[model samples]
Target: MHEKDHSEALKARIKSPKRASRRMSMLLGAVALGALTTGAMLQSSFDVGPTPAYAQNLSAQVPAATSAGFADVVDHVKPAVVSVRVKVAVEGASAEGFDLRQFGLPEGSPFEKFFRRFGDEGQRPAPRRYGEAQGSGFFISADGYVVTNNHVVEKAREVEIQTDDGKTYSARIVGTDPKTDLALLKVDAEGGFPYVSFARNAPRVGEWVLAVGNPFGLGGTVTAGIVSARGRDIGAGPYDDFLQIDAAVNRGNSGGPTFNAAGEVVGVNTAIASPSGGNVGIAFAIPAETVQKVVAEIKEHGAVRRGYLGVQIQPISKDIAEGLGLDDAKGAIVARVEGGSPAEKAGIKTGDAILAVDGHEVKNARELARDIAGFAPGKSVDVTVWRDGKKREISVTLTKMPGEKTASAETGEEQGGKLGLSLAPASSVDGADKEGVVVVGVEPGSPAEERGLRSGDVIVSVGGKKVETPQDVREAVKELRKEGRKAVLMQVESANGARFVALPIA
Candidate 1:
């Protein structure tokens, strides 16, 4: 789904309840077998006591089979559920501020004089509106540590949590990991609190689960459903592995816990996919494994530290795999290696497809990113890559990711005939790299323009090799053409940034 659509769906789930319900009912069957007690009747006629054999026989009948219900599970887990209320300072016009626009008066109108007497003509300070938002959370420890979504308490001026027992306590933010949307909070309580632990084993996809949260400000709401799917990537973040459940999760359910039949938290209620702003039997939660790791890190370090490998990677598509002579469209293709990054230091090159990290198979770019981020900085790991139609492993020592950075574009150029582009040495253009050729002009309706090449774009590399001059670009293109390649990949650097463009060689 589109990012906007997912965000809209998540927001909608917070305000509306699920419209569908699945009622589970159970029936019990009882059968009674009686034997004529002639001895007991004769004893009653004689006024004798009841026989011990008859009473023992009556007690030995088969017991009825009992069906499982959620009442016991709810009773056990609901006490730890909490309602999180946040007070945010919203910026807007205050009620005291008077505007002539409200009276439908144009600028410089005669009525401005009458309004000016009531309020100042100059811009008044925007009113600070105190906005309150509600969500759900649960206690993770007895000492008053609670876990919730980061978005629930983010940017809050004041936070308070209400337990199921109707007692409210002021909550302080302990730590938060925005990447996974998880936060740790602490409440000052007198004694040990009821808490739940994360499930050690992952619940099966079809297993029944319970969700308890404050949906739409409804405190202590309970809903039941099954785990619909696993490892769902809803485009939330780099670590997008979420569990999809059919629970009736709605607004105010953020940061709630999804428990398995054992009453262990299997996931944290996060988002839903609903078009009408309500649960449509599809809700997503952060898996227990991810939550456990993030929460523990937050508790220890107050932040999440992710390992970084400096390279821009893209998923290997079937066509890309075919172009690279690969058997399967698996792995992440390195588009560009950041200068001085660990990947560059370890001799990782552009156009190399990463297949595994430390022997763990990486299926695609997202998987690779998640796996790499899970490691600690300064840890060395073996990375397997496919280059030149062969597999090789390289050991790389990870480093802490520096703040946000973007790869600069690099491109190469050659005598443009079929592509129809005018090229010149990049050194000829100001602020352009000296090792590539710059596009002086692109012919209208040509393959160069169609491939997004434009004037002032520098070509840094052709066919994954650096090119300094037009002759170098021509040589690379000639090599690819001799190899019968249909398209040549060029690394292009423009004002926006660096990106790889595949232009048709024909």
Candidate 2:
């Protein structure tokens, strides 16, 4: 029924939902006038109608936002949003190039080669390829500074933005942070630009939000929804603390602004969790808290300078907590302390559980990483860690994170009895440990394998003590169990990096 029918029905549902009997004044949510490019609407008008008395009663009971309305909010913020267009260079080619085929337009079509002749003034640049992409962004200052996604301008050679009023202006990339997928752009005209500010607080779950963007290159479209959740980690990066919203964000909505009822930008629309590229009501946005910080740094330095404490870490599991005598499975267990890093200088060793930083409780590895990164480099803070059944505070002065790397591990397999781990001295194994027992193998379905120990993982320490041989590991484990501990913690170094694993001594 699609193509024509699909366009007709979508128009109907959006433009003319059923009315109530109580004579409610209708507010047209949004209009995409003359916006249909790929298709046109044949059935342009709908038959007017009224609903039963029950429909009126139900409508009355609904929230009064119908009366308060989003039109005011939309009017306040829509002008700040612009449709950003960029001539993106081909993957490897210079920014002054384009590959039309790679632009994700009409795939498998002959237009690929025909579009290459996009030369104006009888001058075709070199044989390099170029493509164009469009997304949404908003001005954040009266000086014409715009905030958008890093992906919108990454590898962009020429950038221009068309405002809601159809006026286009050339823009320059001010700065970009790919880790947060946020980019700042500057329009260099002398006139003051209409702009919006970031919301001081994140929107609460179920709070109303309006997403304004240029979907499918359609100008200044608006959709309404509520905040679905917060602190969502979509694995986009180590700093991923996205706000989940059930909004109709689409492809061109990337880098657009999601505003609160007060017309303040609450989030920057980023990734959509949909199987097909279209929106399925599950979209993630970068919270404005992150945006304000990142944009501020970008404005000041033209790059984000994040505090670094170079320690590879993993979340504390229940078994690991029990092994370390922790009351709860919280905090991040330091796996490997990078040489010369703040963690190393602070005497933070492998197997230390980082419980808090500057009195802020770190609930997990991601939080700890994010918290540390939030600080400026050269900032000194107190990091609390649990070691040897006690908590101690260590002062660390952070340095600029050279390059961000978050620890992620995938398990593999065979091995022994007892703890289901076959162990040998590091000296006996090729390319093995200088100060620990090497895992020769892991038994399938055993505790060792379940806890993610692999054949090549060098067990560096048992029960907080460094072990050079398999016999030393056994002795340490036996001693820890003799103290009535149900689990033993071992520092194991794998190819990914060093991490702590808890194996049941029982």
Most lDDT-accurate candidate: 1
- lDDT per residue for candidate 1 within 1-506, as digits (tens), equals 99987776555322212212111111122111010000000000111123333122111121322265777777777888999998875544322234455567665677654554445435553345687888899987767789998888765668899999999999888767766888989998676677777777998989988899998886799999999999976655556788989989988888999988777899999887666666788888998888888777667655666777888887888999999889999988888887888889999998998999999998877777877867776779899999998999999998766431111121233423456565777764557677688886555346775555767878889999998767787778888877888889999887656778798875
Question: Each prediction's Cα RMSD?
Answer: 24.9, 23.4
Give the per-residue lDDT digits (tens) of candidate 2, residues 3-74. 986664443211100010001121232221111011101111111133323222111122334576887667
Residue pairs in steric clash, candidate 1? 13-251, 14-251, 15-251, 409-493, 409-498, 410-460, 411-459, 411-460, 412-459, 412-460
Off by over 4 Å in 1: 1-68, 93-127, 404-506
Checking candidate 2 for backbone clashes, the offending pairs are 98-129, 98-130, 98-131, 99-129, 99-130, 99-131, 414-442, 415-442, 415-443
Give per-model TM-scores.
0.62, 0.62
Q: Which stretches of candidate 2 lie over 4 Å from their true place?
A: 1-68, 91-126, 404-506
Score candidate 1 by lDDT: 0.72
lDDT of 1 at 91: 43
Error of 1 at 242 (Å): 1.1
State the C-alpha lDDT per candidate.
Answer: 0.72, 0.70
Candidate 1, TM-score vs. the true structure? 0.62
